[model samples]
Target: MSAVASVVSLVELLRGNPGSCRWTGGLSPVDLARAERELGTPLPPSYRCFLAEVGSCEVDGTDFLGVYRTPAMGDTLLGTVSGTLDARTDPRFPPDLLLIQYDGMGGLVCLDLSRRDRAGEAPVVVWDPGSADRGGPERLAADFGSYALRQCTQALTRGG
Candidate 1:
């Protein structure tokens, strides 16, 4: 499925279990534009679509970092993308790495904007602060959507 389709399905699943799913919120096209403008860079197309569709949400307690939808724009809590990049102490961190999600710990999932994979999308990689010196990121997905598919599916079906 396309990235937007994938997100739609996930959101649908969340809707079915609102009592358990945690939705931080979602973002509008304007919000996406502002975030890109503020960061001085554009986010990947797939991720932008996801934000437009899924925003911020948690699946079975697994929160996928997303833009804040309500009390909405200009909120500092919605600054996950740039915040983590600023706080990173990794000297070898790439110049175009965009922090996309937090693993609820000290680690993050980032998109490599500087380099695109065979599919023309930036590769998603994991940054574990404790292992920053390991010389490279642990590649998570070919793109943000792929990461979502791999992770969200696992998260939803783990015990089903």
Candidate 2:
């Protein structure tokens, strides 16, 4: 199966169990453009597909950040836009990285925007705030699609 299809199918399965996932809905092209404009760089192709297909979501208590909604309406709006902006305030956080998830252990899962493959996909990496200098962020996946596939598969495996 194609990467996008696999990710979408897995997410759908994960969402079948009520309360297992909370999705913010798919994002419009306009919304994507706005996010890209604000971020000052185009997001990776796989990530763009994810935002368009699933937007932001919390699956089995794990957040997979995406484009934020306007007038949030109490939706928390703690997705990619907000998370990246918030992290950028820290001197230690690199200015070009995009935050994708908070690993719940003082570590953040982010896209290494500076490093992209020929397919325009960025590496997914885990940055531990408690130990930034301890060998730097650990790479989690080659791209968002792989990372998300692993997450969805794990969530389903755990019976979520």
Candidate 3:
């Protein structure tokens, strides 16, 4: 499937099975632009589409970070833009990594911006902060579309 189609499928799954997933609705172009400005970079096209189709969401209580629909709805530690800003304060955090989720294991799921493709897609990777043996971020997917597909499949497999 194409990137946009993959994201559309993911959004449909998230919306169709409300028992296992909850979504915060999509963002406006203005909000997306604001988020990009705040983050000081252009978001990947597939990821931007996902955020515009499903701003923020959780599957079985595991939140996928994105721009919140409104300022009042944002959590400093969970909203994509805000969370990334806060994480940037850490000297150890790489400047090109954009936080997308907490791995529940002292690891960060992020978009590796430094490895962005010519099409503007970044690979999803997991960085284990507490693992001395993990020399660098472990790639999770080729792009946000693939990552979203994996998340949707996992949620469905869990009886969503």
Candidate 4:
């Protein structure tokens, strides 16, 4: 599937109401714009379409955090969770694109990068969405789509 189609499918899966699963809050348009501005970059085209169509939060009618796609330098796009505006107060992960926060979950929501189908396992790296690191941006951009697919699958399996 195309990256955009994959994202849409992921969003639909998240919107599924499976028992305890619920629709949580999503980022407001203003908030999204502010985040993009803070990061000093435009979000990915596919991601923009996802947000515009499916929105930034789940549709199950609960208050779970949602995913937003950041700019793609090459293949990967930085991913960020909704409701985390303060990076200092929040334990922002190094590989920020892979970082996620679900409802009622605390601390950094870390996803196993190795479990992803396309990328090889290395140490979990916390990404800084606001600032691109030396060589890190390229890595993230390259692997972001696959990483996102893995994350959505994991979340669905785990009932997150």
* Top lDDT model: 3
**RMSD from true fold, candidate 2:** 2.6
Range of the 10 consecutive residues with the lowest summed lDDT in candidate 1: 69-78
For all candidates in order, the CA lDDT equals: 0.69, 0.79, 0.81, 0.43
* Per-residue lDDT of model 3, residues 1-160, tens digit only: 7666788888878877788888888888988888888888999988899899998888776678876745665433237888888888887788888988888888888998999898889999887654335777888999988787787678678763
Q: Which stretches of model 1 miss by more than 4 angstroms? A: 69-74, 77-79, 88-92, 117-120, 129-133
lDDT of 1 at 85: 51
Steric clash pairs (candidate 1): none
- Residue-wise C-alpha lDDT for candidate 4, range 1-160, written one tens digit per residue: 6555666676666556445343323456775576566544445544444445544443323232334445444322223533334433444344233333342423333333443333232222334443334544223232333445455566556655
The pairs that clash in candidate 3 are: none
Residue 71 error for model 1, in Å?
5.4
Q: Which stretches of candidate 2 lie over 4 Å from their true place?
A: 1-5, 11-19, 70-78, 130-132
Separately for all candidates shown, the number of backbone clashes (residues 3 or more apart, or on different chains) is 0, 0, 0, 18
Best model number under TM-score: 3
Cα lDDT tens digits, model 1, 27-105, are: 7777888888866687777777677776777776566777663354546536455464574556655657778777676
* Candidate 3: C-alpha lDDT: 0.81
Candidate 2 lDDT over 59-109, as tens digits, reads: 775678787666744443447988898898888887768999888888889
Instruction: Order the candidates by lDDT, highest first.
Output: 3, 2, 1, 4
